[model samples]
Structure formats: C-alpha cells, structure tokens
Target: MFNLYFISQSTCSILLLLNFALKNVACNPVVRTKSGCLKGSIDRNIDGGKFYQFMGIPYAEPPVGDLRFKAPKPKHPWKGIRNATEEGSACPHRREKRFNQSVPLVGDEDCLFLNVYTAELPRNSATMKLKPVLVYIHGGGYVFGNGGRAKYGPKNLMTEDIVLVTLNYRLGILGYLSFSDPTLEIPGNAGLKDQRLALRWVQDNIRRFGGDPNRVTIDGESAGGSSVHFHVISPSCRGLFHGAIIQSGSTLNSWPWGKLDGAISVVNKIGVKAKTQKEALDVLKSLSAYELVRVLEQMGITECSNDWQDISPVIEYPHEGAFLTKSPIDILNAGEQNQVPLILGYNSKEGHWMNYQQMAAKAMGTWVAPFSWECIIPWQTGIKKGTAKSKRFADTLERTYQTETPEENVVNAWSDSIYDVGIEQAIKFHLKTHLAPIYAYRISVITRLNYLKRSLNLWDKPGVFHSDELGYLFSQSITPKVSPGSPEDIYRRRIVKLWTNFVKYKNPTPDDELNVLWQPVESVDPIKQLDIGENLTFVDTPEARRFVVWNELLEESPFIIN
Candidate 1:
C-alpha cells in the first residue's frame, strides 16, 4: 500500500510540470490582422496596469534592390501566427554619435516596421468599444531615429486608455534622394510616403487591435512634427487622422522643406560619371544601402545646421505617387489642407540644443569663434546672403535680442529663426481657413526627467532646451525612474493627460480635472497660448512684439507671399 501511494504522488508531479511548460509556451495573445495573425506579449505599466504590445509588425515590403528610392509597397500577407514580441530592425541610418565619437551604422534596409501598444485587448470584437489611437513619428532631422521602445517606450502612456503606435520610415539619401527628371521615377519624399502607408495600415488594421480608426491622432517631434504638418497639408492624407500634435517642427521651417541639389551632390561625391538622370539613377541603385548611408555621414551632415541644404522633404514634380507636389505655404494659403484639430508649439528655448556645443566650449575656456550675424538671418525670408536685405535683417535681429553675451544672442536668435517663426507662420496660415480649434503652447517646465538637456550637461543652464517636454510624455530608457506622487511624476502625468485628452476629445481641457483651462488660439493678431510652466498660465500676445519685427522684415523681402 505504501509503494502504490508513492507512485501516485510521482505521477501527479510529472503532470503538473508538463502543464506549466505548455502554459509558458502558448500563453501569449494573438490578434488577427488582415496580413496575418500576430502574436503579441503582455506587459505591465509603471502603475501596474496590464497592457498588450505588438512589436515589429511589417507595414510595408522591404524597399530593396529595384524598390530603392521609390514609394514603399504594401507588405504582403503572411501565413500562420507571426511572432511580434520582438522589435524589428530600424531603418538604415548611422547611430547617434556622443562626445563627437564616430558611431557605427545601425538598422536594416528592410526596416519598414511599426509597434502597437494597447491597454486592453478585445475578447469579443462585436461588443468591445475601441480605444483612441495615437500614432507617433519620431524625429532625427529626417536622417536618424527609429520607433523602438528603448527611446519611445509606452510604459507611461499605456497607463491611460489609448492605443499607441510608433513606426520606422526610410531616412536620409535612401528616403529623400530626388532627380530633376520625373521620368527617372525618383520623386523625393519617399520617407513621407512610408509614413502615409503606415497611417493607412493603422486605418485598416488598428481596429483589430482594439483601436478606433476614426479617432486617430497623429503626433510627432522635430522632423516627425514637421511630418505631421506635412500630412495635415497633403490632400492624400485627408481622413487618415482626426487631429495633429506638432512639437518643435513645422512645414514652414526653412531648414528641411525646400529641395536642394542633393542628387547632383551625391553623384559628384560618389565620383559617378552619370551624364543623364537615368545613369545617375542606375549608379545610385547599384550602390548598397550601407554605401549610401556612409556617403551621407561623409558629407558631415548633422541635424540643425544653419545651412538649409540637406536631403529632406521637397516639392516633387507631379506624378502618380508624389507625396508633395507644391509648397506647404501655398497649400495652406489656398485652404487645400486637411484642416484637423492642431496642437502646435515649441519649447521656451528651442535654440539651446543648437548652441549647446558652443556653450560647453565657452564654459571650458576653449577657443570659440566670434558669433556670426549671417547665421541668425532667417533663411525663409529668401534674402540672398551678403545682400543689402540680408544685412539689414541680421542687423535688426542683433538689435532686437540684445543679450549680455553672444551665446545668449545665439540662443534667442536661432530660436526664432529656426523654430518659432516657422511654427507661428504655420499657425497664421492655418488659421486663415481653419474651422477647427488650434491649441498653441510653450513648454517651460523643468524637471529631473529632462534627459536631453541633462545628457548634454546643460541641465544647470538656463531655459528649457528643445525636446525637454518629450521626457514628460513618454518614458524613455535614459530617464531616471519617477517615484510615485513626485513632482516629476505629477508633471509627467499632467502632460500625458493633456495630450491624451487632445487625442480623445480634440480639446486639451475637456473638463479641466487638472484645474487648468487650456485655451486655443482664437486669432493670429495676438496669438494666445498655454504656457506650461510651474503653473499652466494663459498668456496672450506673448511673442507679439518679437513676431511683429519678423512680419515687417518678411513683408519687405522679395519672396512673394501667395
């Protein structure tokens, strides 16, 4: 009898071990997409709220070989359940350098992937209410960055009832190389096309992941922010998203908007004797993806240069699949844009990042060059360099922002020239025919979560640097962990709430549970904005005097306003 009881106990233990192993192997959630079934994983937010993550889902086919420099093709359907627990490779781009060190290239050419995060998964689609979607496009000056969770994690955002998505698009030469000849089939703005395709993918498949397609809000920072504005103006992107949140970027930003002689420059740099556009195209296509990106690095192209020439978005010649065919200013002036609810703004000191290296050099007592007035001249004014108009504008800028030091002058001057003027201009043009409310803001809150500023050793410096507000919205890996009920945590929570509220209700202060009645810009004469600082104060005509000078200067310039 004792032997029989021992044998029964052993048998039960073996069965229990086998059951545990099976559960571990097959417990992941699987969602059926139009392309195929995607197996995602579950994660818990900082607040211990459970959320579902679907990572590295291919939205477009690999733009390789013949598909290079062309619009992304839709990803073909796949068989069986695809493992989406891991992130796909980022698009081909050089790794961000630190301390002026040369970084190796990272990512793959076949990197058209996107990640989706949702707080809840629908058990029964017929009875479940879908959540609002927030599609984020990352910014790297149209050259670097990815939609990976390491940089743009959904930990804080997942605590709210929303579906978050981040996507990877083509970058640099591979994405924006355009030939003058339309017949060459290389119209620029392929990167923008990649983004548009991802949005379409969201519309068609987001519902399956418990997302509401009709209530999608597109958000981006820097180049990605400008991308959001581009979509807002593009006729093809109408109805894809209901609202836009543009942070530190705009279509009117002179740096990344206009076409440059990129194709000719590439041909000359690569030593290709291409006499015709087709020959240049052939030579470009023959080069490997790594070779193409290596060339861009060799060109010494860093983000936020005073020089406007770069491989960025351009007005493409009219073609069947051209992403942008006209100037964004013209499009806005004609009221041909998608007129969605917009929340556009910049940091209190947008130029801090641009002047960081110089500031550091000064602090270290290193040899720093004298400030050049030419750098501060607004490139959008179209005044020729060294011309009488250019000198007059530069002189005016020097007098206007009369700071104690040249570095301070640079910070203020670049802030207006590079970021503020363009964004304000976009708002002005958008308001001319805007039927929807425009919520403008200036992020001035400073906290421990200011990762970008801290990383550059500028945390102790005055003024909130560009992209400081991003730390409050999304939990990045570099940022220190926020303690519950801490000041940083409270600020982060408030920012997230405001953004998510805009995503849901199109009004940031839907009910003002946060006790801040954020108002929208009612007129361009004196643009009102929410100053997100220690206190959410409503400021009217904050930049009126500054912009008046800009307006007068632009009016005197030769560039005709449509």
Candidate 2:
C-alpha cells in the first residue's frame, strides 16, 4: 500500500508540471494583424494588472537605399507569424547624454516600428467591446528618442482599460532635410509621414487588438507635442485621430518650423559642394547613416537653438506626397485644420532644465551676466537682430521677469520665449476659432517623480522642469520605484487617470473621483486654465502680465500670434 501511494503522488507531480507548461504556452498571445500574425509576450503591472504587449511590429518597409529620404512605404504582408517579443532597433541617431557627454550612435536605418499594450484581447470580435486607444509620439527634439519599452513602459498606463501604442519615426537630418528643387523628390517631414503611416496601421489593425478604431487620441510631449499640433493643422493627417494631447509644444512655437535657408546652411556645413539641389541629394544619399550623424555632431548641430533647427519641419514645395506645403499659421488662420478635442499645456518651469547649468554656475558665484539681452528675443518673432524692435522686445522681457539675481531672470526669459508664449498663443487661437473643447493646463506639481530635474540634480531647484510630468504618466526604468500608497504613487495614479480618462471620454473630469472640474478655454480675454499641483485649482489667465508684455511687443511683428 505504501509503494502504491508513492507512485500515485509522483504521477500527480508529473501531470501538474505538464499542465503548467501548457499554461505557459497559452500565455504567449497571438493577434492577427492585416500584415500577418504577431506572437507577443505578456506582462504584469506593479499592481498585478495583466496585459499583452506586441513590440517591434513593423509599420513600414525599411526606409533604406533609394527610400532613404523618401516617405515611408506601408509594410507589405508577411508569410507567417512574426516574433514581436522583442523591441525593434531605434531609429538612427546619437543617443541623448547628460552635460554634453558624447554617447555612441545607437539604432538602425530600418527602425520604423511600433509597440502596442492592451489589458484585454477580443475573445469574440463580433461581441467584445473595444477599448479606446492612445497613440504616443516620443519627444527627443525630433533628434533622438524611440518607442521602446525601457523608457516608455506600459506598467503605469496599462492598469487602465485602454489600448496604448507608441511608435518610432525617422529623426534628425534624415527625417527633415528638404530642398526647393522638387525634382529631387525629398520633400521634408518624412518623419511626420512615418507617424501618419503608423496611425493608419492602427486604424486598420487596432480593432483586432481590442481597440476602437473610431476613438483614437494622439498624445506627445515637446517635439512630439508640436508634432501633434502639426497634425491638427496638416491636411494629410485629417481623420487619422479623433483627439490630441499637446504637452509643452505648439505649432506656434518658432523653433520647430523653419525655411529653406536653414536647410541650405546644413548642406553647406556638411561640406557638400553641390551647385544644384539634386547633386546635394545624391551626395547625402551616398553617405552612410553613421557618417551623416557624425558630421552633424562635429558641426555642433542640435535640435534646440535660439534660431531654427538645422534639421526641422519646413514648408515643402507643392508636389505629390508633400507633407506640409504651406505655413501652419496660415492653415489655422483660414480655419482649414482638423478641429479635434485637445488637452494642451506646459510645465510651470519649462526652461529650468535648459538653463540648469547657468543656475549651478550662479550658485557657485561664477556666473557672468550677458552684456546684451537681444538674444533673448526668439527668432520666430521675425524682428531682425540688433534692430530697434528686437532691442525693445528684449528690454520689455528683461523688465517683466528680471529678478535680483541674473539666474532667475535667465530661466524666466528662456521659459517664456521657448514654451509659455507659444502655448498661450495656441490656446488663444483655439478658443477664438475652433468649436471643439480645448482644455489648457499648467503643471506645477513638484515631487520626487520630477524625472528630468531630479536626473539633472536640480530637484532642489525651484519649479518643475521641462518633461517633469513624464514620470507620473509612464513607468520608466530610470525613475525610482513608487511605494504602493505613497504620495508619489498617488500623484502618478492621479496623472495617469486624468490622461487615460481623457483618452476614454475626451473630457478629463468626466466624474468627481478626483474632486476637480477641469474646464476648457472659453475666452481669450482671460484664458481659463487648470493649475495642476497639490490641489487642482482653476486659475484665470496664467502668467497674464508676462503674456500681455509679449502680446504688445509682438503686436506688429510678422510671426503669427493671432
């Protein structure tokens, strides 16, 4: 009898192990996309919320060889199941570094991929109710950034019942180089075209992943945010998305848009001695991706400058597949944009991250004040440098935000000119023209989760720095782990809820769970904005005095403020 019992127990153990193996096999989910079948991995959030992740899914064919400078082509159908368990290579660009550290260029030319995270999959496509979708565009000044899981993990966001998608587009010179000679066929905004293709992929395949095709919202920050606003104005992107979340960026921002002069300067700096644009195109195409990036880096080319970026969105000559043929301002002024529900805002101290070194130098008593503040005037204002108009604008800015210390004045000036003024202008225009609800906000919440500031050792510094709000919305590997019920965790939950709620209802405050009634901008006289901090409060005309100063200074300027 004892021998028999021992044999039975061993048999039961073997059966249990086999059952677990089968369960493990079941956990690897498969979803059918229009291109082919994709096998993905499963993950759990911090709170044990289970979700499915499909990574490294190609949305476009490799933009290589002859396709280098051209717009992305739609991905062709594959033969069998593609393994999407791993992330695709990042687009070709130099990795972002701190304090100007030189990092190795990482990624490949065939990097037009996207990732999808969903809490549930449709068991029966005819009966299951699809969830709303949020497609995120990463912000790296349109120079560096990818939709990989390491930085933009879905742990925080997947807890909500929504489908989240993040994607990669071409960046830097490869993405934005343009020429007036349309014969070369390298109309700029190929990166934006990549994004549009990804969105089209979502519209076609998201339903199979349990996402509603009709209820898709596009969200992005910084350059990505500006990209969203660009989509709002671009005719090519009409009907691609139903809603938008523009964080700390706007089409009105001068830095993101440029003209042919800037493009010509980049070519000249690259030592391309082409008499014609076609010759320049051939030279650029012959160079390796790494070589192009290396030359640009040696030339000190970066996404951000007081002037337009060396590589940036430009008005393309009218031709087939031209992404943007006219000025975005003209599009908005003519009310010819894709009007959609929008949630747009900026961090309280958007320039703190940009001027942290200056702040540190001042703290050490080694700071030297600039002799002339004329450089503080943004180039978008179109007021010629050293002119009376430029000097007057500079003087007014100095008087408006100048404090006893030069560091404070510098931060304020940079913040207003780079972010605040443009965002406020966007809000004003939306309120005056669009019938859709436009919710404007200013995030002033200072906490340990202020990722950018804390990473730069500026946590002790005053005000929330640019991209500080990212920590609360997405779970990144670099951020500190949040204790279950801590204030930081609560803040994270609050932010994620607000954003996902907007994704679901198009109104952040659909209910009173958070105890705040977030309202939309109704009038430009006193632009109503939600101040998101320890407590959500409705403030009338954020930084009104400073905006008034900017308004009067740029009243007669050619750049579009109205």
Best by lDDT: 1
Clashes of each: 0, 0
lDDT of each residue in 1-562, candidate 1, tens digit only: 2321223434433533443355444356667788877767888887987788999999999998778888999999876557789999998877644213246778899999999999766655568899999999998878788999877999888888999999999998888888768667788888999999999999999988889999999999988999999999988898999999999999887667545346666676666676776776677777788787876655553223235564778888787877787777788778899978999999888888767745554564544443566665655666666787677777887788875476766787778877888898888888988888999998888999875786666766777788888788887878797888999999889899999999989999999698988888888777888888887887653355688887887677622321
Candidate 2 lDDT by residue in tens digits, 293-372: 76555455322324566577887878877677777767777788888999999988787755764444445444223324
Error of 2 at 209 (Å): 0.7
TM-scores, each model vs. reference: 0.91, 0.91
lDDT of 1 at 428: 89
TM-score of 2: 0.91
Report every candidate's CA lDDT: 0.80, 0.79
